[model samples]
Target: MKKTRKLIYLLEDNDDIREIIAFLLTEQNYDVCAYPTVKSFNEDIVLGKPDMFVLDVMLTDGNGIDVCDSLKSNQKTHHIPILMMSANTQMFTVKEKCDAEDFISKPFDIDDFVKRIHHYMD
Candidate 1:
């Protein structure tokens, strides 16, 4: 039997950032399903659950904190690891509000980013 790739649901509003992260994760051999808006992500999430979630703190339509809260509260998706990313200086407050497994500051090192992802994945 063929091994299945881990699916990651990524929500980042910035076009460049979304593309870059998606590309980086793909190159690392993980399957990524990226979305720019919360509405779009919400629509697709009902179809399937990802092995992990990488959410941006600030979004064009919605904030990732609330998304994180919703997912954590839901019985179906509560167990999946969520990694929150932000360039915001107030991430400490953001971190306290959500139940994500990990938090990473933006402008993060590429090597460190991959390592964090693998930490939860493996």
Candidate 2:
């Protein structure tokens, strides 16, 4: 018997952070498709959606909150869960503005990160 891995779309500007996140998720049996820019992610979203989305709160090109709000408002991708990753201490303010499922402040414990991810898993 085998398990079907969940596909994750990760958007982060820092290459090292993205790689580390991808590695951790992959180690946990997730299929991660990471993008450095929101532009690339937006382009790929049209091709297909992912099981989950992990977005950086601050992007070089755009704000992740706007991205999450757009996706939540859309008809097609509204059901997918989105997790916002940020180092911002004012995450509650940002979370209140958008319709993200949850948020994780950066320098977060790996155990807590995994636990939060599972909390939203279907």
Candidate 3:
């Protein structure tokens, strides 16, 4: 049987960031579904769960940490690895509080971003 490629669910409010990350992940052979908010993400979960999640720390609707907490707390989705990104490195405390699998600061190196995605996807 052929193995299925892992899917990555990305939640980022920035259009440029979303496009760039999506392009990068696609090149790396992962299927990506990008969303701009928790509401849309929640809606998509009903369709199917991704192998992992890439979440932004801030959104127009609310804090991404809160969304991460919700995903982690839920039995159905808790197993999915979550990689969070933030522009504010100072929010390391908040990132820790969320208990994400990993955290990447914004303006991050492309190589580092790809490495983190591969790390979690693996």
Better of 1 and 3 by TM-score: 1
TM-score of 1: 0.97
Candidate 2: stretches off by over 4 Å: none
Highest lDDT model number = 1
How well does candidate 2 score on lDDT at residue 12? 95
Q: Provide the clash count, candidate 1.
A: 0
- Residue 77's C-alpha lDDT in candidate 1? 97
Tens digit per residue, CA lDDT, model 1, 54-75: 9999998999999999999999
**lDDT for each residue of candidate 3 in 1-122, tens digit (9 for 90 to 100):** 98899999999999999999999999999999999888898889878879998999889888889989999998888999999899989766866679799998999999999998998888
Question: For model 2, how many clashes?
Answer: 0
- Mind giving the per-residue lDDT tens digits that candidate 2 earns over 1-122? 88778899999999999999999989888899999999999999988768999999899999999899989999999999999999997888988989898989998899999887777765
Q: What lDDT score belongs to each candidate, Candidate 1 first?
A: 0.95, 0.90, 0.90
Error at 18, model 2, angstroms: 0.3
Q: Which residue pairs clash within candidate 2?
A: none
Q: What's the residue-level lDDT of 56 in candidate 3?
A: 94
- Candidates in order, TM-scores: namely 0.97, 0.94, 0.95
lDDT of 3 at 60: 88
